[model samples]
Target: FTTEDGAVNAGGSLVLFDTATAQQLYLKPGVFQNATVSAEAGVSDRKLLDEITPLLPKDATAQTGKALADRQAKDIESGLTSLNTMLLAFAGIALFVGVFLIANTFTMLIAQRTRELALMRAIGATRRQVKRSVLLEAGVVGTLASVIGFLLGLGLATGLRSAMGLMGGKIPAGPLIVSPTAVGSAFAVGILITVLAAWLPARRAAKIAPVAAMSSVHATASVKSLVVRNSIGGVITLLGSAGIVGGAASGGTSGRQLIAAGAFFALIGVIILIPLLSRPVIALVRPALKKVFGVSGKLASQNAVRNPRRTGATASALAIGLTLVTGISVLGVTLGQAIDKMTTDNIKADYMVSMASGDSLDESALRALSKADGVTALSPQQAAWFEVDGEYHSASAVTPGDVEQVFSLTVESGSLASLKDGQVAVGSKTAKENGWKTGDTLPVKFDDEKKGELKVGAVYKENEFLSPFVIPKELADEHSASTRPEIREIWIKADGGASKANEQAVVDALGDNPAMSVMDRQDIRDMFGGFINTALNIMYGLLAMALLIAVLGVVNTLAMSVFERQQEIGMLRAIGLDRGRVKRMVRLEAVVISVFGAVIGVGLGVFLGWAIGRTLSADIPGYALVIPWDRLGVFLLLAALVGVLASLWPARSAAKLNMLTAIKTE
Candidate 1:
């Protein structure tokens, strides 16, 4: 049975065709809707389908109803799943950071107010009441920040969608409404993070006696507590990592392998060991920085190592977000570079003109197109995709002697002079990776039945975008019985700038061919990989926010530090603690936090970036880790600036404290 809808591609009936006879038989004016669209006939002949066929395009109502049902269900399900995954990762980062900030801030607040809390206890206030008061304060602050952050996230997601839209990717359909469920979830998360952040300090507050608390003794040995705490956490972390790696190597569950064994283990290890790690890591640098980096440098190093928890908390914010964002960005950048190179390879034409519906373009259309002004060269490609062994793949047959002319290639081993060798040519990359050698028998299964056992003539380095190469035109025709291409894409090279004049001429000649999509080489980047750009832009924005949050963490940590040291700051101010020195100290603290974060963040990014490269072979494979040396420098500079900026307000706040008042408070 056969069918053709010349004009009203709108709807059509089922039909059959005979290959050898070049005959089409119309059984009836009928339409059939099946589970899959039939691109070509297979084993079953027309006689079988025609015998049982009905004369209808299925039920118009049922056809559309099924389509709508499937589409909506898929979209809704996929959209929710995507949203959940994205949100979970981001939330983990945000919450981990929030935990640090809340803990550090509460610790600082309690320390500064140690004498006050002790005095309160000395009076009539119970230890429970003192702890409760502190908790109440934290709750208020956390609630406010979370509400603000959620609202900000709503706006951020919209901006993200718009950026993606510009890159031509379909985001979740409909307005990205803030789901009430999401809002409630965020609120609960915020409160929980706040309460937990204050938990330890509240306990400390409960334990302090009036006089001892007033003396700053609860926080006096905090430095020692930090060592012990980080030590225990570090042991657990290393043990957990060993377990994960050992289990994963033995083919344990993939879920646990990727997450628990790999990502989670690394993340937990970093967070837990961050403080101890920062000490030795920063220790080696203090001497070098002290002599040359000036006073600010020395102060920065001192403050960074002074309070382990605060430093860890501040750095953790940047580390958490940067790890994930950098991981993804590395993947995107790798893919981008790979795809661009691929595009440059596979498309060997100044311009590609293809039917939107992928209709066949015969020699006649090719000739017609060539007759237009300045049409110097043309290449035609035929593409068909199929699946083998459950793996989907594509094969393209092309006759571009000018493929070298259009998309230039370097012959690594075999000569282009040996083009008609009836051997299959594979990319140098593809050949080397697959252990393919010249003169080796390469078996390729085209579709289901057609098999080609071609000798690997020569490995050619494909610098442009391409798939596996094919035999020359005549050999291909004989092998496939001269089966005409159902679809053709034309590449045109003209005399002038992308052949603007000739492009217009060709468009006019093919004006009636409504099913065609034409593109010049210039449009390749935007049209071919627009979605990728959108994803990058979204990530860049998210990273920017994370950086901002990191700065906020720095500010929060520095501010609390300054507040805790009000008396010390006041003492300095009274006895030559230059307001400049005070600012320097605060700024130094900020710098310390930023530098700490940057080292760990950059290290994590590079290490994981390398790990991620193992998943791909197109570009720099086998742990293709790049330091992004430039970005690292920029991050370092930005961290310094963030330190100074974060310290400014807090430094002034500390400098402004009255010596008498500061001393009396504790």
Candidate 2:
């Protein structure tokens, strides 16, 4: 036990640690005097020696060392947790995106060989057998991707580990690991997702009647489909969205993730329901557009509207991709805004000073540093998280005179003067998240046996992370002078025009300070900007892969359409329609499809992105989102380009349809 003015006070202590658990106990003499003594018996290997020694008390010294180690380890752990979540989400998105690409490839292959499958059925093969063959083909694709994806995952994880370290995040002591569980999850989920995505298209092949084998072309004119007001798929979709929104509204981490996952499924379900749900609308567009654009335009519009199945199938692929991309982008922005706003309001410091050693600077150095040229003010701040009333609350040291000059904090209730001794100013967001209000008294235990009551000052809406804070520096010094606070960063305020202050110059002049890293305002913005940009790209890239699947779906659908319409094109050539006209028609058909998909994608993507950004901002600091207009324009242009590009080969084939030969094929 250390004495403050000869009054005995046991320092905050860690009482339990094992392979599975670790605990730190902060006690007060009246309520928790024997906490260390009580918990010491729990650890078999590292039992605490209760006896205090003269000169250097064994328990007190060990406890201090343990506390430092624990805090560092926890910081490192928090960093790792973020890294893992980012990667896992990316991996899931990549897998989900790949499903469309692979599914399209299989679908086209099946469509092309429709007559073949029908022939097999005619020759005694069962529908179940045809389904098996199609499923087997999908299985092969899944297996190949899994192997490649796994290899990439390992390499990616390695690079990711190094990148995190370079970006001021902690790196584990060993090489980046791939848990068997993660690998197994990827494999199982990947295969299952692949097979399920292909099932519908595969079923289409299996159900083809034997008459289809004898026909050289799909009898689109003769084939009939059952008309319905609403598809079963569409009903499931609306219900799914309701379930997801309801679950998310219930709150908590699991609920949020479920909401996201539910939305993903919702989009997929919507895609499946598009044919039935959009049929009436498409039929309406056909005649109305026909009169507006005349014969050729009318025909193109009619064809699009006529085959709800094909058009929806093709359009839905792109829609799904666009929705995901847009949603993620929007969410990134909202998250950024929420976090930034919170940080801005909470951090009210004029400048924050760090005192550490070796490169260690402490109270003496801060006193010297605080009086440096171009330094108008400084707050020597010490901060830590402690459990109070079964919840984690931040504890800080603050003084009376230095409060205003340092933290510019606006009290919602109690005055900054009220922070005279044991008062604390809580953040507005913190208060809301933790259900705290003004006039509520909270008791905090620190230094093992020193318990204190901090009267709540008025809540403010600034991120304590961005500015000087609610507490005073002297109180911070006195509290942490004996038990050092973990001081990894410092907040600084410039004396001259902040616009003119040369932060790098000042930092260089100060020399190397081991205890802290100096960062200017621009530095913080740039650092966060860099991370946000990287994060945006990562999210975009994953969704882009998903969109690629849609592109493939486009290529697949158009190829099938081309073959199915070959005779018609040949007949058109025989009539007055030239190669150019036929090709134009095909290309127009593609444009029509792409426009529909792109519009939907833009709408869905924006909504999802905004919602996600809002959620993220509330959770993490420095994540404020601003919508990127330039990117939005780029997204539209890219969709158009990909649409035209997908039609390259098909356009050539459709243009070159041999009149007599094509006519003879049927």
Residue 544 in model 2: lDDT = 65
lDDT tens readout by residue for model 1, 1-666: 343333223232333454423322212224222433232355343543453345435553223435556887788788789767876766576667667777877887887778788889998899789989999988998899889989898888889778767866554456576778988988988887898899888888778878766665445545677678777777766765565445434432442345344666667778878878888988888887678756656876887888776688788887876776666666666666666656765555668887666456755666677677777676566554433334444545555364455656667776554555666566787677778777788565654357656676667775444455644544544544234553367777777747657678878767656667778886875665677678877777656656777778888887777766666666666776666766766777677778778777766666555454544443332223344566667766777787788888887887677777886654
Whole-model lDDT, model 2: 0.62
- What is the number of residue pairs that collide in model 1? 16
- Model 2 vs truth, CA RMSD: 9.4
TM-score of 1: 0.71
All candidates' lDDT scores?
A: 0.67, 0.62
Candidate 2 lDDT over residue span 1-666, tens digit each: 233321122222223434222212122223322233233545532344333224343544434446656887798679789878876776666566556656656666776687888889988999999999888877887788788878887887788777877876653355466788988987888778878878977887787787965585342423234333235566667766765665545545665676677676667767766666455655555665557655555656666655666777677777777777776666655655554465444544433334332133444455555555676555544565444666555555544555456444655655666567556677777777768887777776543335666667657655445232355554444444233444434444566635335454345445655445565544544455466667878777656666777777777777777786777778878887777766666665676676677766777677555444544444565565567677677777777677678877787798887888877755
**Estimated TM-score for each candidate:** 0.71, 0.71
